[model samples]
Target: MKKVVLAYGPRGFGNYTFDTETLEFSGSPDTRSGPLIIPGFIDIHTHGAFGIDFMSATVDEMRDLCCELSKVGYEGFLPTTVTAPVAQVRQALARLPDDPMILGFHLEGPFISPRYPGAQPQGDIVDPPVGVSEWDPILDDSRLKVITLAPERPGGGDLIRRLSNRNVKVSIGHTEATYTQCREAFAMGARHTTHTFNAMRPLHHREPGAVGFALTENDVFTELIYDRHHVAREAAEVLLRCKPESRVLAISDSTMAAGVPSGTHLKMWGLDCHVSEGTVRLADGTLAGSAITLLDAFRNLKEDFGWSTAVNACCINPRIALGLSTTEARTYLELDPDLNIVARYDRKK
Candidate 1:
């Protein structure tokens, strides 16, 4: 491991100490110089990493992905699913592993808008008020924690209400809904926004679309991808300025290509995508998903915000969003004085 340079705590660098032998980290700004230690992150909205795609990977492969994520800094995460046919989606959902690190499952599509499909295949997008017989099995899955949809399509409000009543987190995304429509959805139990500002209506000055509502609504949780490409730093500043730190969290929205070598091409959702410059994009250059982990987002956030703020965004906030105890993370990511990852220790066996 590299020698000491800085420590990231409430007070910043040089306030902590680490013993590589004992692998213990202690802090407060006056302790002997050592590595920067932080709680392992919980990503609520990641697709896959290390060449694994949650949409198609077997349970065993997903477990392998979990072990790989642990090496960086993640303690738990949702194996998010993309839009697909009902049978296909259920088959994918059925593959979720019952691992402690697998927090839950996120149904990211099949009930979203076609107008703002983003990288989601337009053909697979389904309108609101999903039929009960087919979707009931999906909704009944105890591990189904979140579902993102546009609340303006047919049966949108009803679908939002149904999911909310079942304690499923309803996030607004991929819609051209007006401010009033979004507010109505929020009233119906939509409390979050998916990958805020991407694949959502732009925040028009007068209209104040879904993006505007997400930023201004104090109770609305916003998930941001801070890979410097999905969302620019200035936009993040605006979001942070408008919402409380607790209501703002970070997500990777990463694709299988995230941890793979750059320039690698793969067929994602029946489209050609290539990883380049840490981004997976289509032939026309539309972003498929990010190519970064929560650790990468944490580093980017700390560059703009302080270390304390970054920890909240990357570690604490996402867990809180899932109704999990913020104190549950025991895995520690140890970074050298320069904050480079040196090692990680999982205190919880």
Candidate 2:
């Protein structure tokens, strides 16, 4: 067997040295310099990667995507769904992979506003019927983690209550809800916002839409797409300022266009989308989604907003939002002078 010396610690410290041959650790007692190490990025909202679209991907395809993502430092993610026929949505869910790394499914639409539908297909939008029980089967599964809905829609408040009672995270997004409506939804148990400041109402002194509510409310965990295109550098800094630590989650909101080099048109929710200038837009010039992954977003946050480190945008706060142990959470890794992954371990596990 080959013996190798491994360095381990947060922020690329060589303080805790380990011999990989026997899995025994020791103190290096010397400072090492090389690549900056960070915890495996967790993306709670991602649709697909490496040319696979989650909405139509088979179980094997989803697993393939997860395996590819692992190479890029993504440890886990949610398979996001767009507005589609109920039958198609159910079929997609039925075909999901059972791997724990897949985490769960984030249903992004089908119950959102038609006016600000963004990249979602307009034909697939539907209003929830009174006493609708169709979503119960989908939501009953342990793998369904979060659902995004417009709070002002018909029966949306009740839906939020029911989903919250079931312990499923309900996020407000893709809507035109007024301030009062947002407040009522928060009172009823909406605890998160989807891609704050995009595809939702903007914050105005008089209107105080979802963005305003998210900024003011203490309990809501707001997800910011830090791709720079989604939110400007100054705007992102302002959001981080208003949102309390542990209450902010930086998400990718990535689409199938991620990881692909550039200048490629990909199909998103049945619409043709092209990546240009680091933003994914539909053929008709509507903003579709993001072309960057969570890792890229973290780097952008650090480079643009001086966010201290990638850990500040990637691991620490997201873990807290997911109700994981922050003290024990792995945020970054220490690299030896060679810039290799020395020894790796998670803070929680």
Candidate 3:
């Protein structure tokens, strides 16, 4: 029998020296220098990875995504659903894997502001059905982690309150609500904003729409895409300045084009699409979604926005917002003496 030697630290592995076959730990720590290591990334909102769209994925396809994500250092994710028929949504939910790393499900639409529907099909938009006493059965076995809705829709505030009471996190998105309407929803328990500025009304001094309320509220967590295209670098800086440390959660909002290299065709929201110059758009000029991943978003936030640490965006803050236990092993990178990646093992491994 052999052993492995690993040096662990706060962010990630400091050094790892080992014998592969024998599993023996040996030699001085491999000291190489590199970018600071961070915990394996977690994505709160992502529709798909590789070429498999979540809407169309079978249970086996989701398992494939989990394996693929492991290679890229993702520890967990929430499979997000776009606007679709209720029956179709239920069907997709039925096929998800029971893996713990597949944390839960995020319903991005079906009840949203029709005016700011973005890529969601206009046909799918609808007022919440009356007297739907329980959504639990419809969601299958997956925990309903988060739901995005337009607070201005009929009974929208009531829906937020209902979900909140059931311990589900509520987010406002794809909305055209005025400031007062957003604030009212917040009072009733909408605690997050979905991909903040993308499918919501822009911030204005006069209107103070969803973005405005998100900036001002200390309790509301806002998900930012951080692909540089979703929110401009300068504007992102401004948002960072306005929101509190506990209220900012970075999400990939990634589409099926993720993980695949540039120049791949993928179907999105029932339309053929391609990734061009980093943005995924449809033939009709509709901005489909992002092609980037959570790790890429973290890198962009650090490299472009001058963020000093990934903890707030990546770990501590998001866990707190979601009421999740902080017991998971947090990973990060550290440069060795020679500035290289030192593969270290930790308890979670």
Best of the candidates, lDDT: 1
- Candidate ordering by lDDT (highest first): 1, 2, 3
User: Which segments of model 3 are wrong by more than 4 Å?
Assistant: 1-35, 133-136, 139-142, 307-309, 327-349
Residue-by-residue lDDT tens digits, candidate 2, 318-349: 66556655434333343344334354443343
CA lDDT for candidate 2:
0.75
lDDT of each: 0.83, 0.75, 0.74
Summarize candidate 3's per-residue lDDT along 1-349 as a digit string, tens digits: 2333333323333444433342233444456333443445678889997877889899999999887866655667889999998878888888998986688889988899889998888898887555653444753343888988999999787788878887788899999988899899988988899988889998997898998988888889999888888888877877889988667888888888887777777678878787887888888867788988776776676676543334467655567666764434444333243323354333343
- Model 3: lDDT of residue 67: 78
Per-candidate total of colliding backbone pairs: 2, 5, 23
Identify the superior model by TM-score, candidate 2 or candidate 3. 2
Q: Candidate 1, residues 1-349: lDDT per residue as tens digits? A: 3234344433544555544444444555675444466768888898898889888899899889988988888888888888888888887877887788887789898788888999998998877655666777787788889888899999899889888998899999888888999999999999999999999899999999999999889998899999999888899899999999888888999889878998899988788999999899999999998999998899898888877678888888887788875643556677764557787756535
The ten-residue window of minimal lDDT in model 2 covers 1-10
* Per-model TM values vs. the true structure: 0.90, 0.86, 0.85
